[model samples]
Target: MPNSDNPSFQTEKASERLQRHADEISVRLTERGAVPNFPEPDDRTLRSFSLGEVAEILGVSGSYLRQLSIDGLGTTPETGTAGRRSYTLRQINELRAYLARTRRKEALKFCPRRREGEKLQIISVGGSASTTTSLYLAQGLALQGYRVLAIDLDPDGSLSKMFGYDYPGICFPDRYVSMYGALRYDDDRSSMSSVIRRTHFHGLDLVPGNCELEIFERESTKRFHSEDLRIADASIKMVSALKEVEANYDVVVIRCGGGIFLTAGAYGAATGVLRTVRPEWPEIMSMRISLSFLSHFVSLMEEAGMSVNHHFTKYLVTRHNPRDFSQQEAVAFLRKSLGHGLLTATVWESDAIRDAEVKKRSLYELVAGAVGRSAYEQAMETLNSTNAEVMDIIYEVWGRPPMYVMRASRIAGKASS
Candidate 1:
């Protein structure tokens, strides 16, 4: 037998120490009629902590807590107000574990706990180049504290580049790194997750698209003989790919590219389709044709009782000049023709937006004294307002009150400063 002070004796005494603790707990409870200091794993596991309480416990600032949520580290809080958001004891423990792992420089994983009725918005635009509009919308959504995944369905990869993934250059040699792999006829269904990439912005992820998708698009055309089946199949694959990671995002915005076939695919996958129409007659005429086509297809599908995901088509009046009578008239004409289908906010054409695009940066990132700073500031104001308005409309469509309006205001103030 080793001495009581020896390591071997201490190891043997550990169980005795626990037994003594239990005896003490019983003595204290009987004498004082109060609970002892023993750990209550059950109570701790069932406990819920408020956001502020969690922040206090963790010794972090409110802003830091918000960023943790933005970075997909914290659980989403109940809707109403940020102050009302609560974290479960389990979530708090998970966050602590995450912090410990981070301190050790280990790779971290984020798995979002999604609530019911969370929407998946797949945005599309009218005309030749809608990537810029899509990027701005995504930026706005992320700023509003929503997890956004922007999918660049275009072969040009313009949206990918806007988010800092260079065209053709960012493609990995070892794996099929784009949406191309997911759409292929192969049985590998997990390829969509591989295409998920984090962006420079918080709360935003990207599914990088490139010219490589053209090969898949062409192959799809050759394989599917019926136009309906072809469009249906493409939509199914695209939507399925999105659903693969649907739990991780609040919205999925697809900046579509390629020909009518690809456009049809987008239409099939959309929960909501945002179409931007310039204030011009020819473009307006083209939009009318597009609307008619969409309506006809939806009507046909409904009549057939086919199981399909129908989308609400919302029109945005872009490139407007309020002072220009022609542009104003175009907007008025659209409102009268489309009634409630048209978005209330109009996106003005500004050199500031163009300058930011030239620099490959977002309006929120443009600094003062940059070329067209005044114009950019004006554009930024309008963009913030439009983003909020559009968000309200979307939330209304999804049958929920807007959760991040206040957060959006905070983000706008931060960007302005």
Candidate 2:
């Protein structure tokens, strides 16, 4: 009001202000020991699993695995002090392959990998705890012998950080390509395979996202305003990009963000959708809004002659406190409303999980006693239960028997005999 034309009265442009803030943050992070463009290939490593853990994961007896090691079959595990044995994830997978070949009748139970006729499973995970759910699901599947690819579609790169790839600190714009590179509308668009980065978890890979992914939203908005037919096509970008690398993976888990274009693309390409929710009123209401939006989106795709069908759409309850009466009632309400769509297992909110996250690691990456024994076991129990439920759904979709059910039946038969 004093002087409209004065340079001091002029406001800074939003883009410039944002750039300044980012630069300041970069300097602060650098000062705090975060190296810019840091190459951290060996920073995160998976811990070896003990013999009992390996046997449980393989659905076999510990003595059976011990005999195999004594007989020098498959990959020999590392023997520790007191003659205890531990197996690396790579070794576990080798054992899986060996068992699948030797035991033809239980081959699927041993390997559980996608075969010739089994279509690649593309799961789009979203809503509350989506990043954590995707991380655990991808790692859990890998531990169980499935080749998994996890794609981070969030511009914030939260899922990427969980995999030890902090794009903001480690990624070089000129050297690394993100998922946006593969989904861009321009001629410089690259293949999805080119952006795949291996994580420390065996048999699992990651396609990270960075700030550049935000550019896609702007570009898509412009195209939509121009009435571009390509923008309206649901099966254009993400579906085609994933098809390039479909043969290499047994399953692909995408961590969806809020961008409309990328979210729609994820929905269009998904074989299944996992919606995570907390046992709370606010989260339930938010999920309702999300479901409404999804319904409308599916209808629009159908009108456009694109069949938007998923093998399954399931809800997973996370961060649940069982002792809380209100949370219990919320879960009960969800179960009544969702019926079979809601998974049987709920992920309990645990201090152990929160502690691991603070250390920028997942529970699978930690040793048993790394975070108090009782807490770790409880956290793993819930996580494993939830993951196994999802795996049961996958098995059903592939027309295979549930591995747990089959194992239980085999145990009962052995007892009867």
Candidate 3:
């Protein structure tokens, strides 16, 4: 069963009605004194569905069930001969719920008016400082033509500098228009429009960061101590800011800091979290620690009576060196361990990326002139391929086309209007 706090669990009609549907069928069969030809598995036996049985239950063919598993939509059944494969009742229920929602979506598509305020996905990218992986992914998405707003919440200002902001710290006065401004609680929420600044890269905007942003921790702590703020208030502030400008961008990527206070806030507001981990021993160890922290944070949020809408956490392998035996071994381990949770994208090691960082330019803007032609091309290919995979994951989760495609749809909608 899905967690009660999960938004999808709360609103998915098919999921909510599963038990009732079963009960109604059971009652009708009992009245008729019918001996059911097929076995009706108990709901408690969620992990006991054979492939053929579940297929019959969901009204989908066995081949379709296999395809869904292959496409990473549902759990992979234990493999056996063509007639012997088996699935879990939980997997079948989930698939049925998914199909129901998809059918509902298709029906809604032909309706007269689209729903107002379609969700603007806010993806929180969290990782250690060792790999500036979040920044690369953000730039890649922007270059791929998505309307992307990248908020730099790290007090180190690395993301700020990468976009050509030379300042080490945001000045005091500018705090009102920075991330601090957006998360600052007041009677009238500050407009994120004024705080967002255009970056040099096309389709990418920045919510500039600086060391001064660290003051958010102090302010949040003060509010919490005074009993005027809840544990979830920081996240509320973040979500509210994004909602205010929801129509302006297709996606919002927040770069979280090292501190739990900031990262927890970002997690609370995120639809999903992208975790970048390098395939090295030390980095893998850190990744474990980070995962544990995230788990604890979610538990605390639930305990504090906050409704968590977060659906998934994905892992991206960064700084991978194919030739290194240890890295190859670790990558293999991760693939087996994480299974579908691991992204198809892998950021291969490249010196050109380091060069771009030193020059304070986005990797998307790097050219053959700055680095050797061959090296630049190779780097671009690796980065673009990795980002493209990430984009596929985004599309799957958001169930929407890219911003450019959405623009045409919007225009056609208006012309009809």
Candidate 4:
């Protein structure tokens, strides 16, 4: 049932096998009318047990190891001599530890529960111009049952737009989407719980945006009292507000206007967030564009001071065509070329997502009556579960999804392996 395309589905397939062990032997004997050849020995003299033996020691299975093998992790036939199946006790222990570590990550895919007096923190970042990859993760986490309040930090107001809130075309909604505005008029905000404006869905909520928000960037620049500017301090201020909100909600997803960095020329909000990041936290930047545009975008971002640090950066391919094998090939090529910054999910480009956004509805809300449900389901299959695989690793490192979501993008499939 696990496919390499779905990172979380990788292995952990044998969790059931470990439970079935005792009864399985009896069932096998009764069904086949023969005693099984399954190895049964304690730690001592259990030098060799085939793949099953290793699984027994690890309380896993050959299928599980086979998944790891597919990922090019842990012991393999090549790890032993003469291509004989082999697994060492030490390796088994190491693999178990690794699995445990990955499991912890999957657990945090949801929001952390709050204290009695805590207000839920809702942060969102996304835009209509340049899309960030974090939106996918945010949407996924929201689906996982987190109380998320997304802030539409983008001037185009796509995040608010996604919820069907019309962006005031004439005046910017500065007060509606800014930290200063929220604080000014947010009387009786009440445990920060009311901060979230619910969508058609149950767990997800948002504070809509208007075109007026464009002023903050300019206002922030002026307040800083500098010409050539950066938004690092503004970012810290926003984070502090989020920290207060966090007391109410478990997490916040912030949607930005364009790309990973806020804008070009001078001070950008993303620059501020990145400027304050600790070496420990990891952020996922999702880009929705042509593979042909990747290097160009990287170069442009670098010129704009948005260069990625390979150690903590990640690239996501969005609005892709799952049927377009070329896109998959392009991603692999980029990964090889970039060396360490490419990450992917099985989501395909579907018009339903766009249509749903246009209708101010979410996929879960519209999927039943929507057109792209099948493709969306396939896309869901592409991501791993919280219990196992690389998804867990990413969720653990990243903590929360990025703030924005891209709309009306097409997805292309990966080519043959």
Candidate 5:
């Protein structure tokens, strides 16, 4: 009998089609080394290069280099032989073209949905409880009129629900499209925009999370080769993808899931570095564990062949309660490395925050209401104070930014107001 089963037949057909495409891509890689062009990239065309090689070529820090090497920078590295990391030349070349495009600042006017020209910032959030921080920060990004894609890399999908996510809409997008699924199953989706999902906001798009992320962990653990494919790898993939979409958004905000302390095993980590060591006291373990996690995360990324670049990350501490030990410990650890954009307090923790959240808004959004207005006025004052201190740090570190300007901005603003 000829093929009669629709589901089975479709799956087989899809598999076959993907295999053929893979062969074609493989051949192309052989010819081009994944770069779009040999040495000359033109206005009408895009050139590609390998991710790691590009990092070497540019001499950027390691953390920034990892951004280039994404098929989807798995939160961990995809390990095969001991100490070996792998990447496809096609994906690598795609990333190379992306960086090249951005570096050249070439004028691209492709996507009709996109406005004429805007600078897109790729902001990825990583750490436990990054959702709240990302959302709060996203309000600021949205206010700036930059198109934003808030990606929920966690399996829990908290960010998706924060603004209300749709399962059927994404799962069965128009024609049951899983941009990632199609790539894995049929090799149709090459870039991140191919899977871009719209959110409630006009300027925001989402590539929401799914329970299948659990399977990615499970399969990786079993196969053991993809150990370094941490979720951040996905950040690299999406960044490269967005770059291909012609820099559609001004900022791409990624919400990293919980601490590596939770997913260390999945990443095939030493387990000791990823886990908290037990001291004489339970509190001691917790204390040391938090510190260890901070250092360990950077170390793990380095181990996976990604360099640590300070410009690539900013640490934010939330809740802001003076009494909480964990929060206190975290803040102390964070304060040592100041000037990297730390929001030491959550606005909701204060009355100003509750009122602001209830309004489905930001503290800045409430500048008109009496309480909202008062809070923001105070916030600006505080911001000015903080900026002065940061400026001092900069002056101390660099001996440049005249200290007078820092003190003067606050004093001048106060007198004018």
Candidate 6:
């Protein structure tokens, strides 16, 4: 061991040294061009959807959409090679709005935005794959014409990266504010609307997360130990914050982090809770512990006179490998154990999803065949099917028929006529 009197042995505190290392790493990454400099938020644009994709998403026939374009009804789509047409997300929304206005009978189908008496839906997604699940679910809802707000509660800022906020790389504390600014218990707390940032996804906004969120956890814990009952009330700070921008969105999807304080706030604000789990045995066991903790948290909230009720609570199995016997066995076991609480559709593990993430994009943001055709198709099928099932649940909670069922009824009526 070095002598204490030796000047060379003098060192900064561990925390200070670690922070310096992080700053050095970030600087090195920028210098090496390993990460792109932060682009303008408007510079990140979603790819246009082909005519078939728009038709499917809008639950309308291709012929009807083509005729509408010919008649100058909605925004004209961009004509591509060989006269193929594609619609930007903004154009798609314009078409949805036009159809909802002109065709009142199918307005709900055309524009699924919430109506009077419908409370804003807030879904909290937690567990190992929370970031991935939240990313797809929020973008999927936006694609289907629902106004969505995605709040990133993770200190790691993984979900923020997916939305083009690259945390330390692009989103620095001095510039962009995280959800912590809105949820902080001090007089400096800002309105939630002020912290909200627009994303490339037309109908989806983001409250990006950064290192500052970790401060909320530390402060809240200190308050709790000091016998501050206000901390209990602050557990619903997210709910209070969301109310300020409630009218702007139909749903809010929150990616829960590991911090108990923030996770509790997310749980308190949620109208629904989706717990994601991998199909491996170890992960399943870990999920059981998480569920037990959730139960205890709910009890505590209830004891404090806070209503802990949710519209729905569901488990989603992610990163599923159908070819693996062990994973198949795990899925079967989960289905048996969780019963109706488990979603029927599982998100398959696909190379396409991994590839997209490497580029800091979601599968939804990629054009068809951007990845290998077969891989992309399989990945999209898994995502669409999984999100569809969740949407059906949301519809059921609202006492409305499933979208597929409504579409089928309309088609049946046309055939009978």
The prediction achieving the highest lDDT against the true structure is 2
* Per-model TM values vs. the true structure: 0.66, 0.87, 0.65, 0.48, 0.47, 0.86
Note the Cα lDDT for every prediction shown: 0.66, 0.85, 0.66, 0.42, 0.43, 0.84
Instruction: Give the range of the ten consecutive residues with the poorest summed lDDT in model 6.
Output: 167-176
- Of 4 and 6, the candidate ahead on TM-score is 6
Where model 5 places Cα greater than 4 Å from the true spot, the runs are 1-121, 166-190, 199-202, 225-242, 259-312, 321-348, 355-417
Estimate the overall C-alpha local distance difference test score of candidate 5. 0.43
lDDT of 2 at 127: 97
Query: What RMSD does each model have against the real structure?
Result: 21.2, 5.6, 24.7, 23.9, 18.7, 5.9
> TM-score-based ranking, best first?
2, 6, 1, 3, 4, 5
Per-residue lDDT for 83-168 in model 1, tens only?
46666544655665676566543211122222476566666655534776788888767644467888887777788777776556
Error of 6 at 61 (Å): 1.7
lDDT of candidate 6? Answer: 0.84
Q: Write the per-residue lDDT of candidate 5 for residues 58-99, one digit (tens) a residue.
A: 334456656533444422333455534433323433444455
1 or 2, greater by lDDT: 2
**Candidate 2 on 295-341: residue-level lDDT in tens?**
77767667777777799999999999999999999999999999999
Where model 6 places Cα greater than 4 Å from the true spot, the runs are 1-42, 169-176, 229-231, 404-417
Alpha-carbon deviation at 54 in model 1, angstroms: 21
> Cα deviation in Å at residue 265, candidate 3?
1.1
**TM-score of model number 1:** 0.66
| Model 6 C-alpha lDDT per residue in residues 279-347, reported as the tens digit of each score | 999999999998898788777777888887799999999999999999999999999999999988788
As a whole number from 0 to 100, the lDDT of residue 24 in candidate 3 is: 74
Give the backbone clash total of model 5: 28
Residue 20's lDDT within candidate 3 is 65
Ranking 1 against 5 by lDDT, winner: 1
Which 10 consecutive residues of model 2 have the lowest summed lDDT? Answer: 407-416
